[model samples]
Target: MTQKTMSSLQRVLTSLSHKEPDRVPFFLLTTMHGAKELGISIEQYFSQARNVVEGQLRMREKYRHDCYYSFFYAPIEVEAWGGEVLFYDDGPPNSGAPIIRNAENIKHLTPPKIEETPCLLKVLEATRLLKNEVGDDAPIIGVAMSPYSLPVMQMGFDNYIELMLDQPDLFAQLMKVNEAFCIAWSNAQLEAGATAICYFDPVSSTTITPREMYLKTGFNVARQTLAQIKGPTATHMASGRCLPIVEDLANTGTAIIGVSVLEDLAELKSACRGKLTVLGNLNGIEMRRWTLEQAESKVKDAIARAGSGGGFILSDNHGEIPWQVSDEILMAISEAVHKWGKYPLTWLEDHG
Candidate 1:
């Protein structure tokens, strides 16, 4: 619909993959507050498909940041598996009950066929709208659940973990089914014109045994789903330090790994080497609590430490910052990265 010389998404994607750019990229992970701050209501935006697309377009124009997520969430994956959700006024939707409570319930589980599921179809439409409207100005990143997380949707967290310990075979079978669902779902987004798919598999990193990560999930289903996609794929590890499994994860060969606070961003960069890109670890709460200058400084520091070799893209260490994060503070963080972040150790002298 509109055109610009250089947009945020293109810059970040190029730099993070180790290519040179006009400058280091400034990428903000969007949250409810970011939308509201831009004059859109979070409730109204996420509820409707057009609203979601407009909201993202508005964000890119306002912040001029490098990338934006597709405004889709992991709960949608559970919904595809026949799970129900209860929405709230304040935060994300929560799954009401596991679709597959018992092994026998597996028979009833069917992945939502794209046309048949209104919620999912809405996302596909939103993605198409974004890809067409934004074009190359910004890269639209899609999301899919890790095979490990699908079980938590089918069977609650406690049940899924116990099954991993007790009935390993059933767990693997469930993962395979979910993996197929992911391949289909992610491909739908890619075909819809997404530049990349952001895969969330916090459960595997947080709860499962490393044995499960390696022998069962890592080398098998997760790799299989990643292999199915032609475009870039990113895996977001939600919980604490997933460092131990980072190498095995790198072996899966996704293009980016989204890191949380538990992860040492520097170590993650070192481990992935040239094989993968590291996305975040900004500590959202800290960003809110500290002064804008302090927050900006932290962002600069993270970029310098993690982005040194060039595969690091900046984002908060955790989920979206709360709705109260001030526009000035947000702007400060965004501006700091673009101003201070550069190649060949931009902040090295300041740090030393």
Candidate 2:
């Protein structure tokens, strides 16, 4: 079977349901490298609706990624609340300063209105364009940050973590406020045609002090925000330090769990134990240095091990598919999936 005979929506659901399809599905959170390689500046691409649509079309035609990401993040929403962002020429923007640095400042803080933000509106327009162009060709996904990431991006991570120590109540209150932002922004993207949303929180990993992550972050409020999204959701942490929190992450009720470089597919598969969909394991750092054929072989082997069950999807631990792989390498990955991914056991034999 070929893509001409199937729709992107069908492919997603089919994979989620644990059934073998003509080819494995592709999903991405966001890709800065893809944007840069395509020669579209972030400002120019994000400024107009057509630029956003064309960028996605080029990626779809080139890599055949099954899902299209809006390339927006939660901090952009904070910008609406009057926070400042430092934009870069080649990657996602960074926050300039914390909007609320002290527990005492919490009393004066007011959440930003989603409809009024400039950067956020750009994403809304992109979502609308995605719906119009590839509406049924591929599912579109939007992103939001978890409480751990939201506060730190709005207020410096160190400052916010200190507040957590001096006053636990303040930490809880801040998260409560941030949760509202998540709901509003996620709802807006859903309305604009997002079939799913991703909540990323790499800051609360095990590498940080427990007082900062586990107690001050991670578990409790994350549950609340994940519960509010109307569409399917995935919890993404692109850091190796967070592997210890896997069980706690499993409790979030999200549809998928996206792990990072620290964990391997075999480990993730064992940890998830069929409780959640596991979607990663290709090592971005290692592949960046390998030949295209070597990279494709690595991805294929990962699929054979981690993708054996119905719940796994293939992807790199972090970053976009590096341009070094070229069209030929990417096609090799697709071809391998088509050849070896089907179920009903094509080659296995019984010893009886």
The segments of candidate 1 whose C-alpha lies over 4 angstroms from its true place after superposition are 1-10, 34-41, 206-208, 211-213, 344-347
Best by lDDT: 1
Over 1-352, each residue of candidate 1 has an lDDT whose tens digit, in order, gives 2223345666666666676455556557675654474465555666677777777777667666787667455577677656787666556667878877687656455666877888788889989988888787777888877776667777888887787778877776777777777888889888998888888777756435564545565556677888987778888775445677777777787777778876677777788777777778787766666787797778877876676656777776554555556767878887787667655454577686
How much lDDT does each candidate structure score?
0.71, 0.68
**Candidate 2 lDDT tens digits, 1-352:** 2344456677667777766555556664344544554687665555666666677777667666678887553457667778886767745666777777566787667677777777788888888888988767788878877766777777777787687777788877777778888888888889999888877766666655462457436677778888887888877765444556667777777767777756567777777765777777666656546675675567666766666556777776653454344455556665555555544333323311
lDDT of 2 at 337: 55
Q: What are the clashing pairs of model 2?
A: 98-155
- Assess every candidate by TM-score: 0.90, 0.85
* Each prediction's RMSD to truth: 3.6, 3.6
TM-score of 2: 0.85
Residue 237 alpha-carbon offset, candidate 1, angstroms: 0.3
Residue 108's lDDT within candidate 1 is 51
